[model samples]
Target chain A: MIRTKDIFKSFDEKEVLKGITTEFYKGKTNLIIGRSGAGKTVLLKLLVGLLQPTSGEVWYDDTNFFSLNKKEVRAIRMQVGMLFQASALFDSMTVEENIRFPLDMFTNMTYKEKRKQVDSCLERVSLSGVNDSFPSEISGGMQKRVGIARAIVLNPRYLFCDEPNSGLDPKTSIVIDELILDITKEKNITTVINTHDMNSVMEIGENIILLYQGEIAWRGHRGEVLESDNEILQDFIFASPFLQRLRESALGK
Target chain B: MFLKNILYHFGRYVMMLGTAISRPEKVSMYYKETMRQMNDIGIGSLFIVGLIAIFIGAVTAVQFSYQLDGTLVPVYYIGYVVRDMTIIELAPTFTCLVLAGKVGSNIASEIGGMRQKEHIDAMEIMGVNTAAYLIMPKVIAALVVIPMLVAVGAFISIIGGYLASVPTGVMADADYIKGLRSFFDPFNVTMMFIKAVVFAFILTTVSCYQGYHVRGGSIELGQASTNAVVFSDILILVADYLLAVILTS
Candidate 1:
């Protein structure tokens, strides 16, 4: 489990995260949903120790992440995996090399063993036979899958995905979402995804924290999202015409 | 604000270099990466270096022969002039300029593209020391390979001068050798080596730094590459003058 207590972060004079507190439970999909610039990415970065909080503590299990030195932080990071917004695969390397990067860095596995592990991870992501292909040669969805494969190659205890559904078609987005949720459940890893896609919320909003202007607007299951009386979430939910029609039907208005 | 940011990045670079030195695994990776970069910067640029050296040597020899105007000037002096110029200045300085175009731009664009794509951020998330993994290797490779390229350039230029002098019939080969030997200074040789080393350091460091800190996107990466060469070129001229003044004094 990952926990943030009174986390405060600011850029220059503007506070991006205003004394936010949240607990991300293990073995479930925890979604951080917000409009653009609602501090969703900042919060995610803070949780992962990419950005240090101005004042507060982030605990991964029992260790205070901010308080630890860089080496210690790296040790913690090794146990965690992140799929970047842009996929972040090294362009110069082939897909196989990209997947093998972390193992090459931190592990002492023989080349054959590493190859076996990489092959299995690729198979898990349904990306078999594209090992020699470059990221540019593949489709966007395939690149995201590669990102996920690279993230999970180490068998991390925690997985964080930033805007995993961005730029993908609706159907592809759901597939990626299902892949994430399935991996989270099977591996029993603490999974936190930052997104605003309502379909994802409906599909795997097992635990969701909605942010509005840097504060927690609502936190609950998917079923509770439509039922919640929070005006801010209501405004966000009904703002889209598609969702507005869905809201009207739900409320019988 | 920009100055502060540069200072902050400089500090980060120093800390990363320190980490690279202290960690065994990191040092090994750095060596492997450096070898790869050396091959790219040195071995890959050989053809261009050879082509340029041949033309420059031929031109210098022909011009000198024309100026001598039937005076008993040893054709071998052409070899000496080409050798000295190539070793003491042209090879080191000009080759770096060429590299600043070829290797330097490549480093800048590659690293800048990585930054723009958030690959550096990805490395950070993975607990990788990106500076150690990326920048230091290029630095070390430049230091090792640039001087060697300069030597090769000198050799090529000497051969070019030899071919030009033999065909022109300005003077006998023996007299040319005598003139070259009489004026040869060991200090000058040392000076050229020193200059090559300094030029290599400046070129790679500045180019890598420019690329490492590039902002925006592909357009910015292009801008960074241009900035790297321009900045390094100016620095090279300034450093060259300063070194000449100090050494002569």
Candidate 2:
């Protein structure tokens, strides 16, 4: 589990995250949803220690993340995995090499053992037999799967995804979403996703927080989204007339 | 404001060097990366270095021959001039300036692209000391190979002077060889190596600093790469002057 205490972030005196305190549970898909420029990305970066909070504490399990020394910070980082919006795979490496990178860097595993682990991860993401292909040769959806394979190759206790489903079609988006959900449950890792995808929110969102102009406008599970009467939440979820009609039908209005 | 910016970059560059030279996580992996960089920096640069070196020596011989025309100075002085100039001034300084344009810009663009693509952040999050993993090998490769390139350039330049002067009947082959052998100071060779090593370090580190701190999109990346080359050239020239003063004094 990860928790943030009054997390505040600023850049050049423009406060982006204003006192966000939240808890993301283990073994669940925790989503931070907001419109553009709503501080979702900033807050997510702060949570991952990529950016320091202007003032607050990020507690990874029981330890304060910022208080750790360099060596200790690296120790914590070894247990973290992140999937970038662009997948962030090393362009020169093949899929197998990309997935095997963390293991090669951090483990004493033999070539055969690393190969076996790579195969298992490829199979887990249903990406077998394309191990030798470079990321440029794969489709966007396939690249996301490869990204997930690389992320989980280390078996990290915490997983962070930044807009994983962006640039994919609906069908591929659902597939990627289900893959992330399955991995979270199977590994029981603390999974945090920053996205504005409503489909993702309705489907895999176990704990969701909505940010509006650097403040938490609303927080709830997906099942409560249609029932909630919060003005901002309704304005956001039912922005489209089609979704508004669907909400009316679901609520028996 | 300008001074503040310089101090900021200077402090940051020094700190970056500190992290970049830390203990390696794995000796074999570092070795593998170092070898790849050696191949890239050495083999990839041979053709350009040799091409410039030959022309540099040829031009120096031809120009100096023209200057010595109708004068009491011996024709053999053309060879001597080419030898001493190539060793003490032209080889390390000229060759490294060209390399600062070629290899330095390339290093900046490569690292900047990776930074924009979040590859550096990914490596950092994976517990890799990104400064060390990405930079140490490049620095090592440059330090080791650049001096070797300078030595090769010096030898080829002497041959180039011979080719231009002797083949055209400007001077006899024996005269050129004798000029090369005359007034040969070993300290000049030491100065050449000293300049090469210092120039190599400056180019690699300065280019890396420009790339590593790059933010924003493609436009910013382009500026970073340009700054890398420009700053490296400026710094290499400055270092050359300082080393000349310090060593020759």
When just chain B is superposed on the true chain B, each candidate scores a TM-score of 0.87, 0.99
lDDT of 1 by residue, A1-253 (tens): 9998998899999999988899999999999998999999999999988788899999899989999987888888888899988899999899999999889888888999999999999999898999999999999999999999999999999999999999999999988999999999999999999998888988898899989888998999888888788888777766778887897789787
TM-score of each: 0.92, 0.99
lDDT of 2 by residue, A1-253 (tens): 9999999888998999999999999999999999989999998888888899999999999999999987788889999999999899999999999999899888999999999999999999999999999999999999999999999999999999999999999999999999999999999999999998889999999999999999999999999998999988888778999999999998899
Model 1, chain B only, scores a TM-score of 0.87
Any residue pairs clashing in model 2, and if so which? Answer: none
Docking class of 2: high
The alpha-carbon RMSD values of the candidates against the true structure, listed in the order shown, are 2.6, 0.9
Model 2 chain B is weakest, by summed lDDT over 10 consecutive residues, at B21-30
> What are the candidates' individual DockQ scores?
0.63, 0.83
